[model samples]
Target: MAAPARPYRIGTGAGFSSDRLGPALDLVRDGRLDCLVLECLGERTVAFAHRDKRADPAKGYNAHLEKRLKQLLPLCRAKGTRIITNMGAANPRAAALKTVEIARALGLTGLKVACIEGDDVSAIVPMSTPLYDEPGTLADVGLQLVGMNAYLGADAVLPALEAGADVVIGGRLADPSMFLAPLMHHFGWRADDAALAGAGTLVGHLMECGMQVTGGYFADPGVKEVDRLADCGFPIAEVAADGTAVITKLEAAGGCVTPATVKEQLLYEVHDPARYLTPDVTADFSRVRVEEIARDRVRVSQASGRERPASLKVTVGFDDGWHGEAGVSYAGPGAQGRGELAARIIEERIRKAHAVAADLRVDVIGASSLFATAGLKAQAAQDVRVHAAMRSRNREDIETLLWEVESLLCCGPAGGGGYRGAITPCVMTKSVLVPREKVRPTLEVMIA
Candidate 1:
C-alpha cells in the first residue's frame, strides 16, 4: 500500500457525552482536520440510552447529537472533513436517520450518513455468562437486563469509510478504534500489521479523550496550572504514514500540550504500560517516546502492539432502579455538630419510621463524606452540609429516604437550612467476554 503525500490531520470533537461543542466547532472551522471523532459512550451512558429507548423509540442516541450535527455537519461538508462517532449509543440507525434529516434541513444534499450496527449481543450472550471484572454471573445481578454490546474494532468501521461515508455512527464502537479506523483507511494499513496497528492505536488512545491531551483534565490550581483554561481547546493529531504523530491544539485557543500532559493522558486508565488491551490491538506504550517539537505541539512515536485479543469484551447493563439524594446545610459556630446530628437523625428516622430496607448512607459533606468510609476523621468546619443518599428497587423507599432528610430541617438538628432533594434512575453494569466470531458488525449508508 502506498502512503499518502502528507500526514493525516484528525481532531477529537468530544470525549464524553456532555463535552463542550464550541471547541469542536473551532477544530472543524479552523483546525483543518480530515476527520473529526466524537466518542460519546460509557457503560452507564449506554444503559441510560436503553432506558430512553424504552421510553421513546427515536430517543436512544446521544442527546446532543442534533445540536452537534446541526453545527458540525455544515462546516464538515464545506471543509470536506468526514465525521465518525459512537454517539449512536443504543440506536445507530435512528441516529443515522436523524443525521440525514438534519442534513436535508441544512440543504446539504447528497450527504452520506452511515450507520454501523450488530455490536449488540444481548440475544446471543446468555444469562449464564460469567462477568469479567468480578465474581458472579449475569443472572446473579438480579436486576432487569437493559442491554449488552460488544466492543467493535476498526475493521467494523473500515467498510463505511471505504464506501465513502460523510458521517459514520455506531453504538459501542471502541473509543480508540474510531480514531484508528480513519488512519487505517487513509494510510491503507493492513489489519494483520501489528506494528502499524499499534502505532495507529496509540494515536487513537491519545486523541480519544478530546481535551484531556490538550490539558483539560491536567489543570491543577498551583502545581499544574493551564493557561486560559476556560477556553481550553480540543486536541488535533497530525499523524504520519509510519504512525509518528504530533499531538497539538489550535495555537490561537487556550491550554498547552506539554510532555507532562501527554504523559498524564498516556497513563490515564491504563493498567499495564506494556499490555494495554483494546479490541483493535494489545498496545505497548512502555517504549513510546514523547518529545516537544514546539509550542502546543508534542511529537509521539515508537508505539507497538501484539496481535488483537481473542475475545471481545461486552458491557452488560441492568436497570438497578432509583437513586435519591437529599441534603440540608448548617452554618454558624456549631455547624459541623449540627450537620453530624442531622445525619444521625435521618439514618435513625428512615430505618425506624419508614421501615425502608434499602442501601443508605448519610454524610457530613464538608467535614467527612469522602473519608468516612475509610474510618478517618476530618477537621471541624463552621459550615457543613448533611447529605443523605439511598438506592432502592421501590420508588417509595427512595421517597421515604428523601422525606426523612428533609424533615431534619424542622424536626431534628438546629440551624439546618438549604434543604434540597433529588431522585434519578440508576443502572448497574458488568463486563463479560464473547468469542470474536460470534459478534459481527454490519454497516449501511443513507444519503440525504
Candidate 2:
C-alpha cells in the first residue's frame, strides 16, 4: 500500500550561512514540518566559487551550506523530515559524496541521498561571441555576466523523491524546486498535472524567499510592534492536496505575514506578472490571490500554470575583454576644489595619451555638488572629499588611466597630496546564455 496522503508543511531556510542552521533546525523540530528548503547560491556566491575553484580545485560547493547541513541533516532524519536544497553550486556529485560521508560519521547508515546536476554552462559558450550583446547586434545595452546559473524546474527533483531519497540536493536549480518537490512527493502529482503543478508553483513562489513572504517585506499599516527582527523566522507553507497553501512563519517568531507582504514578494524581481516563466511551467501570477488570516498567516490560492517547455535555459561564462578601475580620496579644506582640478588634470592627460576611458564616475563628498544643478538647493559642504573611478574595455587603456593619476599630485592643488596607494587592475569575464538541452543532468544515488 502507498503511504497515506499527508498535509505537508514546507519551510525555506535562509541562504547559505552557518548562523541560520540552529534556528532553522529548531523550527523543523518544533513545527514538525515535512520538508526544509535551503537556497544558497547567488551571483556573488558564483563569483566566489569561481575564484576559490581557481585557487584550489577541490573548493567548489559553498562551505557554509555544508556546515549547516552537517548539523541539521541528522536531526531532520530523526524527526522524519526530508530536505531539498540548492546548495550544490558548481559541484553536486562532490557535495553529495561529502554529505554521505558526514552522515556515515554520524553513525547513520542506509540513508538515501540523491544529487541532481548537469546545469553547467562552462563548455557551451563560443570563444568569439561576446557574453553580452554588442551594439546593434543584440541591443545597445550590455550586461556583464559574472556568473550564469540555470533556472532548472522541479522535474529533476521529483525523480529523486520517487527513488526514496531522504535528502535531495541540486546545483543552480530554480528557487521554486525546493518547495515543489515535497508537494509532488506527498500528493503524487504527475509531471504534466497542470493544476497540481500550478498549485505547487504558487506555493514555491510564495515561500521561496523565506522571510520575504512573511513580515520581513511587509509594509502594512495594521502591523504593530514587530520585535526581534534580528531573530526573524523564515516563511513556511502548509500545502493541501487541493492546490492551496497557507503561508505562515514559526510560532513566536518576529514579523507579520499580511496580504501586503505576500503581494510584495509576488512582485519581487518579476518582469511580467501574466507570464512568469519557470522551468517546470509558465506561471500566471495575475491569477494569484492573497487573503489575510488570523495570527500572522495568509492564504495563497487561485494561481494558474501552463506546461513547461522541453528544455531549460543555461547561463555560460567566457573570457571577455579586460578592464579595471583606480580611485583615490581627497579630504580637508579646499578638498573639493583640489579634487576638481585633479580630475581635469587626469582627463587632459588621458586625452593627450589618446586613450578613451569607457566610463568615469566622480563624486564630491558632502559638497552638495549637484543639488542645485539638479533643481534641489542645498548648503555647500565646508570641508569636502572627492572620489573618482574610471573603467575601460582594454587593459592598456586602464594602465594609461592609472599613469595619469600621479601627474595630478604634482600639477593640481596642494591638497591633492592626500591621494595615495597603488592603482590595481581587475579582470572580468563575459558570460553567454544557452539552452538546457545542451546540458545533461547527472544523477547519483548514495547510500548513507
Best by TM-score: 1
Per residue, candidate 1 scores C-alpha lDDT tens digits across 256-306 of 899999999998889999998899999999999999999989999999999
In model 1, which runs have C-alpha deviations exceeding 4 angstroms? 1-4
| TM-score per model over all chains | 0.97, 0.78
RMSD of every candidate to native, in Å, equals: 1.6, 5.2
Could you tally the backbone clashes for each prediction? Answer: 0, 3
Whole-model lDDT per candidate: 0.93, 0.69
Model 1 per-residue lDDT at 350: 86
| Span of ten consecutive residues with least summed lDDT in model 1 | 375-384
- For model 2, the superposed segments whose C-alpha errors exceed 4 Å read 1-6, 15-22, 47-51, 121-149, 217-226, 320-358, 364-387, 390-439
lDDT of 2 by residue, 166-245 (tens): 88878877777677767887887887887677778888877777777656655435654455666677877888887788
Model 2 lDDT-worst window of ten? 132-141
Error of 2 at 212 (Å): 2.1
Tell me the deviation in Å of residue 381 in model 2. 5.4
